[model samples]
Target: MKFICCGNKGSMPVNDNGIPMDTKKETEAGEPKYGLGVRHWQTFLYFFALTVAYAQRVNLSVAVVAMTDAAAANINFPEYDWPEKTKSLLLSSFFWGYVITQVPSGQLARKFGGKITLLTGLSICSVLNILTPLFADWGGWQLVCALRVVEGLCQGVVFPSIHTLISTWVPPNERPVLGTCAYTGNQFGTIVMLATSGLLASSSAGWPSIFYISGGVGCVWSVFFFIWGASSPAEYKRISPEERKMIELAQASESTSEHPKEKLHTPWLSFFTSPAFLALIIAHSANNWGFWTLLTEIPSYMKNVLGKDIKSNALLSALPYFAMFCMSFVFSAIATLLNKRNCISTVVSRKLFNSLGLWVPMCALIGLAYVDADQSNLAVILLTVTVGFNGACYLGFQINHIDLSPNFAGILMGITNCVGNIMSIIAPLLVGFIVTNEQDVEQWRIVFFIAAAIYLVGNGLFIIFGRASVQPWNDPPAKHRRNSTPQVESQH
Candidate 1:
């Protein structure tokens, strides 16, 4: 359940290096405003949406502990009696529909705006969540799978839509902080859902409450999001004219156009052929393999292998995400401070953080593989550290797309994520095939080893080829023919 936060240029401005410049001037109140006016609030709501999205995504994993006849908490609730293989399908089911919409969703966001794309997706997903329990009971596992696919398909628009929104609203200077903060909601949401899901399952009302509560919350968030969320700063109602002017000016300077929106275009051929883009694709896929493995299966591991009761299983399952949430702030601050001081190039910093995020987890997985079941505490510590270190990916390849192409970021993300999530489809299937016996430590060790190999290989490839600078293709087709010459494209 590792997640990404997007970053891009904003009004305060940035140099060609993607570092924030002090473009702040005096306001009417005799003070300097560094961040975007209403855009920051928009960022918050986006964060909230992402949080609800993940909560819906993972709640099933927690609820399923009490869902099947194989395991129970305190109450004799309704049982689906689905086997391990069936559970794997249920968990991975969301990815099928999720994979379908990536590219189309980006195009939709670009044409219709992120506000609608995001709202429509979340609204559908929330409705589906509310209805899931009834459908699962009546239609059985296949129905559950179909429902998950629909949810995934709808929610799949989320990441790319966020990319489109950030590119249009967030200034490059403010991206590291505001964008990262918005994305950290994923970690926070996972922490809360993982912790509370078991309690809800153990409640007198049973597992249905998990879906009911989470789905209800998501629906509520959608209402506020519809009213408050805007695709770009210019569309926002409460934004000050000065703030809007800065955003417009900053966008124009970077794109070399009075209307940067009109200048935006997607270079389909170039993106597919990009070595740098391929590196990110590999990194993203490998990351998902390891991450989805933990997110989808760890609760079962805690309950069956570690012999923990339902309450402890839920709390312990949540611990890694809690560490991850806290560490996101630490990782963001360090990235900000280093970028501010110019201590390292963005290229070097991105690689450093991305590698750190992957490599530490790789090592931890190896340790988790070797540790005995009796040493559950040590294994949990390693899991926490592994996921916590992964928070740095936000500063790394997650934001690297904006550095690659601010305008086409949504499209790039759509492609990379579509490909990467294919791993999500396969990871759960592979886990089901590999660990046929949920209680076997040796089977689990094989899973850990495979994740480690992926992390090692993926990070190595990225280290060899990843880029933090914009590609030449990211420039407008008729570059110098435009109103202004962009700093990156002028040299070309």
Candidate 2:
């Protein structure tokens, strides 16, 4: 049986005897090698996962306006009292469960392989989405909220599992491009949901059809993913010996240590003790607060503040994410070029992109706050640019997981995302409180100010504390031993 190795550099292959040999030597010795062979297909698999997950997740956002109107139309008759507040709660309820599961979900991924964990999560989410339409008779608002929570809990593992797979499968050089591709799914999914849901919801089938459509798509995708995706390169049958050798060589050149058999005994005590980790956590939390606040509430904002019709609002809301999809690849390519050229340290490069990304959004938020609702088109343009700029930050924060510790990247991502998702819970509630029946400009202004401040602070922490150095714990004992050895005398 072949065992996998992890190290500061990346992943490596070891012989059955546990001796380290160059990947080239192994290939020469007729041992199998894995490279980028059929590896691009894995990217497609990940893309599919993201596409389906985001489509399902964003369906609620697309359905919210229609559902609210439906509830209001039936409110006068008798059985239900569906206030706007209840509608907002139903829309936001998913994040509550999503936030609670991030950490545990990551741990579970570590316990299981990414393939199993991801398939399970997607399966559960699909089932819940299908059941969502069924719950309409049980007071649609309450039923929707309950199902949203269940769906969120199941879906919470998606990001962490994706991170784990990337760390295990993708070469460090390829990570920037792959990361961008994975995130672009968010943009694409949002676009598809917004574009299609409006038409779907407008029919007599109403908002539930949006859920059914998205759920059906997700279930279909999940079946294909389970059939196709491998847990790691070792498990992939299509990878060629030459490709495998190249992958092992690239991974081995970076570090000597092998992958840990157990999960990086997350130094929880040390994590708390280290200011660097704390700062990373805090920065990500703040960053997510701004991100989620905008994502979850943008459709509602367009509808209520800009006075747009549902179809128009959906189109406008999707514009920013569409721009983001285009920009993410561009920005990631630039970052990777800089990395290849050694033009700047990894930390510096990541921070530079992150700073620019956050600053643009900060300025855009200020502009958004000041814009008159009458100038809805102008507001939409500025907001689109703001969210588009937000995509640049992924080069820093998203890829930093692998940069820091290839072995524990998944776990660290879990920790960061779990903490970050608290913002998701907070964002919708904050928006609900601020943009009530009065539609107070002052309240919305307060929300924007808070979001801007969070982004600024998060960026500051990243600049001050984030480092791209592979964590010391992930380094091999061999390298340290070799470095520590004293020079020997030449007796001759």
Candidate 3:
């Protein structure tokens, strides 16, 4: 309960009862120490948990590529008539469960601690992943689809909970880096899955072992996370006095209070009425449609259109995510740099990044539409850049969760993620319709064109309307701020 203030001006140590000690002359001491601490360790644990969730979630894409081949061997299907549709269904079924559970999972994160909700979700997902290959032949494709759906549902809470954790634990100045670091898990997970799955699948052991490996990793990470992570800074035992003061100061500046113990009444109407929130949802939804479609479909595309084998296909499919992982850090740093320099407003920085991110992919998709499958190397490069640009959108939307409402970041992220997940349903169905004949280059062009157009429209809306300021509903009036104690500390 004690507080300490440190700065270039000085240091003032305050007692637990809020009494200032007579160290007035010593107040002007030196610079504040800022680096990794117990809270940072907590953040690291949450980030690790998130990485594990993403690793398990995307492992299926790699597994499906191998699974189809294994299943084909068992059924004695011809190479040309392989069960591609069934494979696509398995990849897409996870999205169905993921999209449906976002809101409820977020609610759970808000109601219970994020630590408990996320840990429980990962536990369920790990068990289901282990059970997947076991049920593959016994219950057949239907059982596999059911298990995937279950995995998706459990994994759906991962992002929202992580968002909440970052909002709670990281200071404003550090959020961009933290957010980017947290999101890098998805790209890293994709890289690990794509890189390893094929090598494992190519062995005599076959495809099911890929699931087992990824499942085991998740289970192990879950144990570490449960041990190391606390729900919030207040619950942490080892947070330094200086770091705690920094968090308190930043929260006060942002005007966010500690989350109440009681369940928040749903402000559905208020959320629905916020045009800026709606714009963000639409923009992110469109981005997700384009991103997930490419992610889920790329392996099949590589094999069918480029005629690549499992090893090469896995390598090619992973290239985009690796590029994305690199780009996310660059783009997030650019936004933060812009904010610090006063080169642009936060709203403008977000809009600029969002527009560029969408437009780059649009051009790439268009180029992809015109390129022949014979130009396989060029096609892969374009696909890599196209998906890499997808990470840029995070600079806009991901940071906006904290920008708009640090207090309600968990709920806000849940809402955005829930709405955006609608695209998960749309993307697979759209691809199914457009790429009815996967071998036809022209047919696939239509899918790319549609994705490009959607991104364009969404970015345009964000440019025109998105605002980075906190929601009016959550902000106190100027008079209220004036009336409050000058030394009041915000708790978040």
RMSD of each: 6.7, 8.5, 7.2
Q: Which ranges of candidate 2 are over 4 A from the true structure?
A: 1-36, 71-81, 253-259, 475-492
So what's the TM-score on candidate 1?
Answer: 0.90
Tens-digit lDDT string for candidate 3 (216-259): 88889888877667677777555556667677677667764344
The TM-score leader among the candidates is 1
Question: What does the lDDT come to for candidate 3?
Answer: 0.74
Residue-level lDDT of model 1, residues 1-492, one tens digit each, is 012132335455543433344334555568455533466667788889989999999999988778884246645677877889999999999999999999998888888888999999999999999998899878988998999999999999999999889888877777777778888888888988999988888878788889998899999999998877888876865566666777766566556433355345567888879899999989888888888889888898898778787889999999998888888789888877787667888888889989888999999999999878888888889888888888888888788888788778887888888998998999889999999888889999999999999999988988999998878777655334456557755543
Q: List the residue pairs that clash in candidate 1.
A: 8-172, 9-171, 9-172, 10-171, 10-172
Candidates ranked by TM-score: 1, 3, 2
Q: Rank the candidates by lDDT, best first.
A: 1, 3, 2
Q: What would the per-residue lDDT of candidate 2 be over residues 260-307, giving only the tens digit for each residue?
A: 424234555555565556667776787788877877778778887888
- Model 2 worst lDDT run, 10 consecutive residues: 1-10
In terms of lDDT, which candidate is stronger, 1 or 3?
1
| Backbone clashes in model 2 | 8
Full-model lDDT for every candidate: 0.83, 0.73, 0.74
Models 1 onward score TM values of 0.90, 0.85, 0.86
